[model samples]
Target: MQNKSIGLFLVILILLSACVPTKNIEELAVVTARGVDITEDNQVETMLNIIRFDPEADSLFTSNTGIGNTIKGAREEAADRTSYNLVEGQINLELYGKEAAEQGIFRFINGLIHDSQVSDTMKLAVSNVSAKEIFNIENPNMPAVGEHLDRLIEIEVKNNSFPPATIQDFTRVKTTIGEDPLLPLIGLVDEKPTIIGMAVFQDDRYVVDISLDEGFLMNLFLNKVENKSVEMTLPLQPFEKYKINTIGIESKSLEGEEFHINFLTTHGKSNTKVESLEQLKFKTDTYIEINLTEMSHPISIKHEKAANLLEKEIEKKLKKQYEELFKKVQEANADVFGFGKLYRSKTKDGKITEEEWREKLPYITVDFNVDVKLMHTGTIQ
Candidate 1:
């Protein structure tokens, strides 16, 4: 009787252990990337690109779609189809459609962050086209769609094509009182991933899209990146062709009641088409002036006519852009530029609330000063 009782106890323990056993690799599907968009009917839509390893078959590409009032609901719907558990840790990129961003991306992304499975390090990007288009792009030259997109991001980072903002970085900016978040805008051009420019958002709502030039300048102002490539075209005497590549821009913000940012840039020779030494020097100065003007426009120049012209141009353009961006933020009531934080830090009380800051931002003044230096003419000079 004692032996039989012991045997029954052992059997019960074995059954409990089996029920709580660890999951095997074969019972999991890895998600490489995900795309989110709002459908025409105003329903939330999501596409998950799942990857799984198989010995007998090639790696599988399984796409699942879900529609719901919220992203969580859609994710729950997607979760029902798989026998194997889906893992979000394997995902590296999250792409959002233009409509979804304009509608409000913060709510959906907040859902993703709160989910236990999602990784915080994943890269976030806004699609110039629809998220559906990005998910559907197929190029034969690339290894896999996910891998291709990942490689493209890597290349862009390496080339300094744009500032790097991971999911966590974006979340920090979004939730912070003063700062707004910016994301790179990606699109498929001829079946290839292209970094078009940048998407600026005030909280969850999309405010405005900026071109590469503007994006680069914004990056410089934000101190997000170091090295960048800039091309400036200058008119050479007697139709002599010349171009200069400006690199290594250093910027600093002034400490005062009004916001002022000063930038100093140095140019190096990528190409110069002048013959004599004097002509080379003249062309270099010309290139600097033109490029500086291109960067900033409209200032009164009484002295140092050539250099002053450039300064005025840059100052004018930058002021205009700053005003435009500030207006957009004020209208949206989003503090994407971190002006609130600046005000708080500058204030003696250090207790400016969001509402108070918003009211004061429109009245705030910003000044920009640009200085350019000609580092080298090139190998020929």
Candidate 2:
């Protein structure tokens, strides 16, 4: 009787195994990139670029749009006409239209966070125009739209022109009281998808756009990205020369409200010919002073006794830029530099509220003391 029971159990187990559901790769539509926007009728609009695996083709992708009262509805509508079931597991990037981002993207963000299939590693950005427009851009150099964007962002991250961000990074930054989030701002330039600026967020909503030049400076201050090579071109005067040089920026400290940087320890090779270390320093100093003043930012710096007037002036320019950035943040009520973290460190609770920071921001005055270290001064070989 025991032998009969064992055999019966084995038969039942084999029968039950066939009941488990299975999905083959061909039955699922893998989304490569997703875009969110607000329609003219004020409905939620969703766009997806789907990847098609065709063995003979160089490119494999098609895009479609869906609209509904809510994101879930729109997504379902988009999948209804497709032969395969929609899948979000392969998404590499998420884009938001300016209108959608400005209106507050917390809902969309929360939806993604709650979804089990969608990953947090996917890159997120703000589109300068409609997300649909960016998705529709055509370029022959890329294998597909999705691959083109993937390579584009990868290059920017390597160059430090844009910092790499994942959905997980966005969540942490926005939830923190003293720090805000920044996303890459992309726009179509000459019909090509180009990185134009950074989208600065106050809390969960996009508030401002930082230009490419300003964004580079901001990254240098935060030391947020690794740059393989950083090039700065300035028209040097007072010594009558123009110089294009690469700069090595190392953020010295986590200064509260204002950025404090040390350039003295950082130096890079330049293509411009210079007589000596002194001549290079002189050229860089003049360029810094002229550019900072032209931007209407005044600066002050503390220097070593051995530092010359030119060195001090160059440091002052960095200070000026730092102050200008702080002033802009205060004006926008966004703490992109994690200043709130610094403030909370002093408090007993080690906590900060976004509203409280906004209230206290206007009264905060931060002064920067800058210095520079000149190294690797020579014309690029």
Candidate 3:
């Protein structure tokens, strides 16, 4: 009776297992990154980085390309060239070519939004040249190109060096009434993928590219700045008046030498105000506390006003930079700063369309008030 009972249990277990379906790992091609581009023939080109399950492969992943009418169609063509089933559930990054971005990215992004398998946290970037060129790069140090780029952007965003541009973030900005979208721009520097700048977009169309310095300033406006470092080069002529003469001191001359300072572990906050709704004017007050980590030349700390003067110089330089960056955005007619949100709130109906806001953007005036404080001058006596 005991043997019969055990035999019946085994039969039920086998029946339950047979009801489920499974595929061998070798039969799956797991995609970690995808690149989309438009060919000269106007066909959609798709590049995929797939993880290899075979132990005999030289690299952990391989890249392949396919051209078709649409992103889905292109990938289907790529699948026909491989025996393994192409799976996109693990995709960590998606890149768009310059031409695709210029033509507009909403159509491509719409497909991603509807895909149930794609993760909301997947990162998106724009390639300065072509996605195909980026995928073709072979770096000995980076065996897995997709994984390397994924980790690179993650670390840079965490360090506050680059803007956060995940799919979720992009969707939020795109759907928001008063804001525009920005993406990280990737380029090939010495055959290695590098974060060159931020790609500014006006209503899904690529407008302009801003340098990383300008991107950092944008980060200051959008989010709190903490644990960030900034390097500045100042005119050394002003520091000549503050120089001290020590009997045994031997220092370089201030003539034709630029003052370089590195601010480390900075913390800052920014507050925006609608100065005049009718006049289209706004004001932003920014406060920052910096730790002076390194300096090209030393100033006499015996004077009580030395630190104050240094702080003032930094404030002046930063304020100018902010103004210049704002002017660039205005010229491009892209309101990446979200100033329109303030204007919209003050409207009588609290309604402002993107087209109306863009028309008002060029004439909008902003006053940037920057205050810099030197909290610690590391060992620079």
Candidate 4:
């Protein structure tokens, strides 16, 4: 009787195992990228760039758009139109339009986070024009539209030219208090995927879109991204004899609100006219001073006098720029520089709460001291 019972149980287990359905990879479509936009009527619009294996075409790109009250509803509507199941596990990029981002993208992005099929490692970006416009960019030099955007963002992040924020990072910053989020700015110019700047968000809404230069400065101050190139020009004593050179710099620290950056610069021998060693020294010093100051003025004086004037001008400009950046952050109510974090660190017992920190941040006083050291004068020197 016991042996008969064991046999019956084994048969039942086998039947249950066989009843499980196996997934057919060939019948499912893989999503590579997703774009989110808001229509004029305040409805959510979603576009998915799907990659499917086609025996006739090898790999094909298919776009699907859906409208609904929420992102999940729109996605479901799009999914229903396709014959095969959609696989979002392979998605790599999430692009958001300017209007949609400004309206608060957290609502749409939260849906992706809750979905078990989506990966949190996907990169996030904001489109300067529209996500639809970026999705439509066609370049003969690239493989596909999705691949082009992936490569462009990858290159910028690898070169330290832009800050890389994943969906996970965005979610953390969006929920965290006293901190703002920054997303890469994507531009479609002449139907090409180009990185133009960074979109700054105060909470979940987009506040300011900064140029590449401003973005670089923000990155340097935030100490998030590294590897930067700065150009410096030295004016010779006698008229238009200017020597120009580029330098690679890294941010060392934030002295109060001022940016303290260090660079590996080269000052080389130029074919330009020079009267004396003093003239050369003056021009060289002036160039160094101006570059260190972070000002955009032409060198004015002749001989050694140029060096002094440049130094003073740079010092003044650096102070002014530092003040301006702080004022901008205060007005925007976005602590992109992590001032709140620093304030919390300095508080008594390091136990200040987010609410307490916010109250004290605007009142906190910051001072900056910028120091530039000329390490090398290039191979010629």
Candidate 5:
């Protein structure tokens, strides 16, 4: 009799478990992406990109705009327009308009970071235009804008096309010296979100735009690249280019005074491509040297010799451009290159804050010792 009773109970429990509650995923307002922009009236405008589901047709996305004095207020307004409560759990990406970010992202990013429901790793970007404008973009090659963006970031980081900048990285760059925060600078191209550069920040304010090539170089400075394809124009051959596909940065070390730097890329590739590889090696070395020496810079580069600092006019014009570039960023007081952090490490005091570092930044001089080596020109396989 007891066995019969237990069996009956077990059957009832199984039946109850089998019956799923009415949970309509389609009715839930899922926020896939968010855009923050500033209106002409100087009010904060929050835009939510929600995926609307349909039972009879393909689910489509829609946008809702809310204007208010604060991000929360604006978001609440947007939520009221929909029957379902807006959820942040599905937000894959968050974008701030150029003007909004320039005003300072600290205000907007703070609340989002504190929300437990929000993914701390969601991809963030600075849009070239108003963040809301990006919603009109669509690319069938990558269906679902939010998922496509998430994939773009995942693939690029995997392929080493750009540095890995997540919530952790973004916050770290903001607080840490010898570093500045950067976000992917994205704009739509033919209805697709395209990465044009890396958005540079000094503290929390948007400072400048680092182009794709410059972004790669900055990643190299940050030692972020691994197994990246390197394509260089053969100098002597002209127009002909060679590729070091699957190149990896073994290690990068920055050492020296605040005024000078010793940037090195070590543990280079170690295989060979052809017989009698000396010529190839020499050519590779020369190419790397010329590339570094001819870098188009913003600031000037000069080494002190015999107690005197002198500029050589005969230096490659391209190298001069790099000097100008560095100088511009330096003068702007944005430590995007992490020189301030390097200075702190090499100091005797053992402590220097970002504020103090910035105060002393304008007076500091800087030079580069950029080097690239070919450990082996060929693959083992």
Candidate 6:
């Protein structure tokens, strides 16, 4: 009886194995990155960076192109070009072209949201040029364009230079009332991919483009930054008395009429509050501990009075930058800072509409209080 039962079990195991579909690694085309662009004729064009498994291939990755009226259709068209099964489960990055971003990104992003194979943590970015052009870029230094771009944005976000922008992050902000989404803006500089700044979205449309400096400030308001850098050019006339005089030594000074100081923030935080809803007044308190990394002219940081002067100048400069950046954001009516969310939270119903916030954003005022602490002089007095 035991021998008959063993034979039956073996037969069942063999039948189950034969019923399952088998996939070979060498026959699978793994897509690492996807780029979406709208053609001049208003058709969807999808470019995929597919990993090549053949050991004899010239490169580890290959580009596959397809065009259709929809993303899924384009992708299916792409699959026909390759003998291997096209897979998107490994996609680490998604990029939308300038045209697509301007038209609206939610539609392209919506496809990803419904697909269970794609990870929510994958990074998303907007390109100033066509997404196809970005994929075609050839940089010997960047053998894998998709992975390189992913790492580039990852490093910048870790340094607090760029804000976190994943598919999940974007969708969350889009669904939330009184808040908007922002993504890293990438462009080719000298024929090489580089981070231009950030794309500010009003709802799902690309409404405004902000500079890298402005993006850093947005990160300060939205995130806790461990390291941030700011460069300031001050009038040399104010520090003329602090210049060192070497006796009997003739030298040409490198400091021009303008004195430049570079500060590296060791820690940074910004807190915002609704001072008055009726008056449309808000207050933001920003505190930063910075280290002096570079100084064109020597001003003794050891001296209390001189250090305080430098701190005050840094505070004033940062405040001015924040105010100017906020003004631009307000003009575009893109609430990337989530100020409207704060307003909603303070309301009786804790609810606000996009149109309502847009109408009030232009009129709302924010008082900025910047406090700069000189932490270290970086081996310089």
Among residues 3 or more apart in sequence or in different chains, the pairs in candidate 3 whose N, CA or C atoms overlap within 3 Å are none
Question: How would you encode candidate 3's per-residue C-alpha lDDT over 252-310 as one tens digit per residue?
Answer: 56656688888975798899999999899999999999988887775664465888888
Q: What is the lDDT of residue 156 in candidate 6?
A: 90
C-alpha lDDT score of every prediction, in listed order? 0.62, 0.66, 0.86, 0.64, 0.63, 0.88
Residue 54 in candidate 3 has what lDDT? 72
List pairs with backbone clashes in candidate 1. Answer: 180-336, 296-313, 296-314, 297-313, 297-314, 298-313
What would you estimate as the lDDT of candidate 4?
0.64
How many steric overlaps does candidate 3 have? Answer: 0
Per-residue C-alpha lDDT of model 2 across residues 1-381, encoded as one tens digit per residue: 999999999999999998998767666678888889998888999888887664554556777788887777888999887766778888888889999999888888898888888887888889889888887776666435555666677677667665566788888889988788888888998888888888999988999888765666666555533323333322123211111223585423222332222222232221112123212111111122111112111122223322243355455565676678767877898878666666666567876678877877666655454544443222321
1-381, model 5: which lDDT tens digit per residue? 999999999999999986876547877778887788999888889777787675654657667878887888898888888787677788888888999988888888788787888888888888888887775565555545556667777777666556776777788788887568778888888777878788888888888887776665556555445555533222222111211223485432222211211222232221112212122110111112211222211122222231011112212322444456567777778877666665666567758887887887676554443334323312221
Estimated TM-score per prediction? 0.69, 0.75, 0.92, 0.71, 0.69, 0.93
Which structure is stronger by TM-score: 4 or 5?
4
What would the TM-score be for candidate 5 when compared with the true structure?
Answer: 0.69
At residue 319, candidate 1 shows an lDDT of 48
Q: Sort all candidates by TM-score, best to worst.
A: 6, 3, 2, 4, 1, 5
Count clashes in each candidate, considering only residues at least 3 apart in sequence or on different chains.
6, 5, 0, 0, 29, 0
Residue ranges of candidate 6 with Cα displaced over 4 Å: 1-20, 250-255
RMSD of each: 13.3, 11.8, 2.9, 12.2, 13.2, 2.3
Off by over 4 Å in 2: 1-19, 54-59, 224-228, 233-235, 238-314, 378-381
Q: Clashing residue pairs, candidate 6?
A: none
Better of 3 and 6 by TM-score: 6
Q: How many clashes (backbone atoms < 3 Å, residues ≥3 apart in a chain or on different chains) does model 2 have?
A: 5
lDDT (Cα) of model 3: 0.86
User: Global CA lDDT of candidate 1, please?
Assistant: 0.62
Per-residue alpha-carbon lDDT of model 4 for 1-381, expressed as tens digits? 999999999999998997898777778788888888999999888788888776665548777877888877777888999987777898898899889998889888888888887898888889987788888665556545666677778777666555567888888876765577888888866667788888888778888877776665555454433334554332323222222223465523222322222332222111112223222110111122112323233323334544444444344554455567656766766666565554444446766566665555565444433333333322322
The model with the greatest lDDT is: 6
